[model samples]
Target: KATVDFQPNYDGSQEEPTVLPSAFPNFLVNGGTGIAVGLATNLAPHNLGEVIDGICAQIDNPEITLPELMQLIKGPDFPVSCEIRGIRGIEEYFRTGRGSMRLRGKVEIEENENGKSLIVIREVPYGVNRAVLQERIAELVNEKILTGISGMRDLSDEETRIEIELKRDARPQVVVAQLFKLTSLETSFSVNMLAIHQNRPKQFSLKEAIDAYIEHRRDVIIRRTRFLLGKAEERAELLEAFLLALGHLDDFIKIIRDSKNRDEARERLGSYKFSTATAEKLGILIRSQAAVQGDRYVFSERQVNAILELRLYQLTGMEQDKVKGEYDGILIDIKDLLDILAREVRVLTIIKDELRVIRDKYATPRKCPILAEAGEIAMEDLIANDAMIVTLSHRGYVKRTPASEYRLQGRGGKGLKGMETRATGKDAPDDFIEHLFSVQAHDYLLFFTNTGRVYVERVFELPEGSRTAMGRSIKNVLDLKPEEKIAAMLRLERSTDENGHDNTFREGAGYVFFATRSGKVKKTSLNDFRNYRKAGLTAINLEEGNDLIGVNLTSGEDEIVLVTRDGMSIKFTEGVYKKPQGELAEGEEPVEEDSGEEDSADEEGRPQIRPQGRATAGVTGIRLRKDDYVVGMAIASEETMLLVASENGLGKRTSFSSYRALRRGGLGVKTLNVTDKTGKVVNAVAVTEQDELMLMTSTGQSIRIRVSEIRETGRVAQGVKLLTLKEGEKLQDISLVIPDGEDSPGDDTSVDASEGESGSVTEETTE
Candidate 1:
């Protein structure tokens, strides 16, 4: 068992010091375990800042409810990611002031292209050994301790990937549901409340232990504060008494100065009789004859000097001045004392307020009295019937009966004596049984057989709505305060005969059920139907007469439904006929006959086509060619001659005299170019604004010239003439020729000479 102790002390200075001078308790955030006696506690640590704020909030206002605290605290701050179960109990424990920390994993869902989704876990809880945890899960599956987990095909130290493939027609949400329901990606911790004391043999909850310590400390502080206040008051009183004594001395001196002679002064002072010592000191100063006068007791210089020399207790005994000064100093000291007292009082007041809040916030309400018909049984009769009764209180105690008292009658009955015989010899078996039955601040009751089969009727007070249990009025039990119900229940019973060995009555199987408001019971089971795979009722068969429209299948459970366009339905089981892919058949097209003959030429000599041609392409003089280089040309001359050329002799030419003529011709040119090879000029007059020239060489090379940059050369070729043909002139078998003085055309400058001819140049240039 691990123990943590926080002992604080003051060094008479202002600072309080921590006693445990080693490692602090920060590891608790990650998760840790401790045990004391029969109880043990596990801590799942979270974020430090969050934990501190939670503690401070409780300190500020102890009455804050657990739900409210959870809102402020949010979830655990785990280093690794994980999920926490049983969080509903967390608040109750904290209010009871006995909760451990928790770390949870982070999980999210992502969608793939197929409309299928996968659950992705990005983090795990702290202190969970990656490799070992995975290995343990694998072992559990292999050993059949866990089942219905199919997709754990592989696992690494850090991650486990599950199988997520879905059928072609399957819904994606169903697959996601299965992944969460069937996997070990989620887990929980059950807190086993525990604490230890060096002087005691028992364990305690954290709240009980801390409350005891705080109360003890509060008492100590109150006692110390009262003692300090008493000391301060005593010193103040002594100073006030000294101040009064000083006032009497001042009165005696005034009387002596008014006397006429020493004799007169003596007689006057006697009327106000001072202390003997004070009277003597006054007489000696007044009796000096030379200083004495008739009305004011005045004397000569020598007489006054002699009077001043008279010893007044060596001048240190002139106590009036000393007392007066001391009184003023003491008054200042008292003021400081009062200030300290005021601050201490404020601190106590605050402490009281905080304590009151804590009491109101976390305190459990008294149990509501239940009005069930009382029943009893004799100890001997109960033992004869092999029955055991248990009771619990708000305090923590448990007791039960020894198995030896039961009369065994079944095949597996080696009798209650068997359990007693197997019991460890540490103490009498009966003592353990008695301890189990002794109630000590526990909130539940249990009744069972020696073999550990719980008698549900004997334990739970059935509500009026529970028809199965005789419809007993259990509303009072259900309404019992939060602190009244037990946290959990356990039972001991004889094992089944599956082993096929000698019949020996050991502890049998037990089941735990959670009570719900609707009178429904939830339980943990080895055969869980909630998981997608184990629930065998998958498909609902909806025939033509069946009324069910939709069937909700459990996750990972496949269902097939057959339906006609007219809405008849039928469901198929997994073993039944598989779904067949549906297809459509081809059909013939239909046509409509005209009601009357088509119209002839109208009075204006224009023919009109009937609606019969509506489905046909209506354009004229244009055809859809597989490969035509569509080009738009701007006219440079009054009429431009155009050529169309392509590979494999797919070429033709048409002539147009003007832009209007070209539009009417609707020529489809095969190629257009903006630049020529060797970047030289040829037939520059033919170039026009934005006109693209196309030329093809014999070796299949193509060149383009931009007509906008043309500079006309005033020359023409004789053999291969460059002529400016106009007004729809068309030429064939013509080639480009360079001037005589110019350099001979190289391979790079030679025209393709494939198309019929090239046009001539005009002696015109644009600025």
Candidate 2:
């Protein structure tokens, strides 16, 4: 009790404490539950150390705000090890002292030797009776309200282990959800921190609770100091009397020996007078006038009695010095105690010091975990946030590995063997890596088809496989026509707008760049294809004999590079591509005029490029020769290095600066000198120094080579050999994989390679 004030008990026979002074914020630290006339309180228990820290913060700075206190004290920490979902309710409770807290029972799914699943309940919400919850669950199952329960038994011993068995065919998740709906698997508790203040019950926010505790501590410290100060003053006065009598030991002994009894000795000492000379010799400073009579110091009755009571040993020189020292110390103590009463900061400092000691002794790690959001978490939230290298084989098998699997190397060095491609079926042509790139599991992968259709699938939905294992077939995850093939794939991040709503397809983000094998190029607004349909969406309109060869997302500032099978490449600014004057009518065809294989000098060899609608054919991007078609299309910039691979396993890296910009539909200059030995250009892509290219052959042989390993040569030069292929094995496709943590390069493409007679190149082949 802080004070001695007491009141009569209910029967008026006994007295009771009016209040209990708590050193810690017990209302928050130990929590309580009570109800009175039209009033109730239910406070959740918090960490003791945290509560004290909050109290100390308030004492240190009275102006400390709520959030500052919250830093020391997180949301309520429960004793039982169960999850407390979200902080919103906790925040509201602390701010207004009343809110509902969401709580979930802890459970673990286990399996025995027979692979039968067992649900083990480890903990339950506060105030929930385990026996009652088990009975309720059994009752629900008996009434068929909860399904999938084959048997339920309380296996709880020392810990809260309630074993729940499910039917062989029953889903545990479904059963658990039903239990939560009917039983006490999940529950909520209302927090109301109502306490008595000034004889009136009042609700207290977190800050107010801590402030009240600090204020109480302040009062207790002040009261305690006043009491200590009185004791120190009395002790100091006694020690002064002992020292005075010791200094006049001879005179004291004579006075006491001359007395007939103890009473006479005490009376004689009380009236004993000391001369001014004797007072100076004794080093005693008499501040009271009553003690000084006629310029001579006389002892008071209290001091005289204390001196008379002194033992004989106290008269020794050593004892006398010790008494003097103790008197000096007691005087200092009295001054300090009085200072505490005169100033509030000293009292606060003492309180803080004591609290720190308590906190250090009692602090413990929290048992309950606080989730970022409340309610049942989606499965995706439990998955690891890791970037993966997703590789799709030519036969449509897909797998992903952690992006850290491959280490980058310089150009032309034998790269790491990432995966084996020899598992192709007999009917499959070659198991070469077709689509290889890095993306997070949560990203969206949009697959573009040769027939101009687009399909969307989450990266996580794709089966995970090891580096050497063939993954699950893409057909299993995505529905496709018998002969349909995915021509291009793009990864898009899940984005949110200002309101925190998902905006997967934000207008004005960029355009979807598309290119066809017939030297056709098209650019459609990305917003036009945001609505994802289970069936698919029409990405582009292709001519009768044309197939979409490449797709990428790009801003208008990118450079367009189109490489033809005849070793010709055309470079132009992406913004120069035609823009649609107005939206096209449904089923309307874009402008189409067949450009002859040979140059028609009078026909203005350049295309009058203009943007068109999604359901329209694209304008010519490159004029091709007979039997020669566009093999690759890439979005490039000044910092990009164009890696073009030939069918004969030959490739070279040429900087984008080496190519001159031209209007679309122009007959391009030679990019590679395609002779009898080098074969036709198979793949051309924009790659950074850190990128690695995985090349696959028709015989299922593949090799990874760093872009920097390949020689950088002139546009018209025949490149060096990239891979040593077996007889009858032609290069199929090239997939550029960017290393993790590396900056993204420009758009890339997979081009086909051809096999021809090995011979030295004499002159460049061009239309």
**Top candidate (TM-score):** 2
Candidate 1 lDDT = 0.30
Residues 1-767, candidate 1: write the lDDT tens digits: 01133344455545342222211123323445776566566644445444334444554565655555555444344444354433434543544535543333444444457654433445544555545545655675577644433323333344544333334443333433443344444344454434333435333332333343333334444444445545544443343323322345355456556767776755554343233344233322222223234434322333323333334552345565664466456556555545645675444454455544644554332111111222211111111223332322123223333222222121111111111111124453221111112111111233221111222222222221210111211112222221222322333222236754312212222112221111111122211211212112111121222121111111121222221211111122222222233331111111111212222212242312111111121111111133321111112232333232222211222222211111111221111121221111111112234443333222212222332223322111111212222233222111111111222122332232223334422222111
lDDT of each: 0.30, 0.72
Estimate the Cα RMSD of every predicted model relative to the unseen true structure: 35.7, 10.7
Supply every candidate's count of residue pairs whose N, Cα or C atoms clash at under 3 angstroms: 50, 9
- Considering only N, C-alpha and C atoms within 3 Å, which residue pairs clash in candidate 2? 411-708, 411-709, 412-709, 578-610, 578-611, 579-611, 580-611, 647-754, 682-751
TM-score of each predicted structure versus truth = 0.26, 0.60
RMSD of 2: 10.7
Q: TM-score for candidate 1, please give it.
A: 0.26
Candidate 1, residue 278: the lDDT equals: 46
lDDT for each residue of candidate 2 in 1-767, tens digit (9 for 90 to 100)? 23334789999999886667666667788898999989999998998888887888787788887666767777788888877776677778889999877788887666556666677789987778899999898888889876677787887887898989877766555566567667788888789999998678989988888777777778777877877877776676676667678877788899999999989999888877777567656645454435567788777788898887788776778887788778778767877887889987898899899888888988888777665352222223435657777777777877877765554432223334545665355696556677766688767788888788888877765778876677866655566654677878888776777976657678887778888898888777778877776467888887678887778777756778999898888776555333334543222223323344232212433333444567877777777778989888888876778888888777788888777665566676678878767788887988888667767665554455567767677777777667665666567778776455643332233121222224322223331
**Model 2 weakest lDDT span, ten residues long:** 746-755
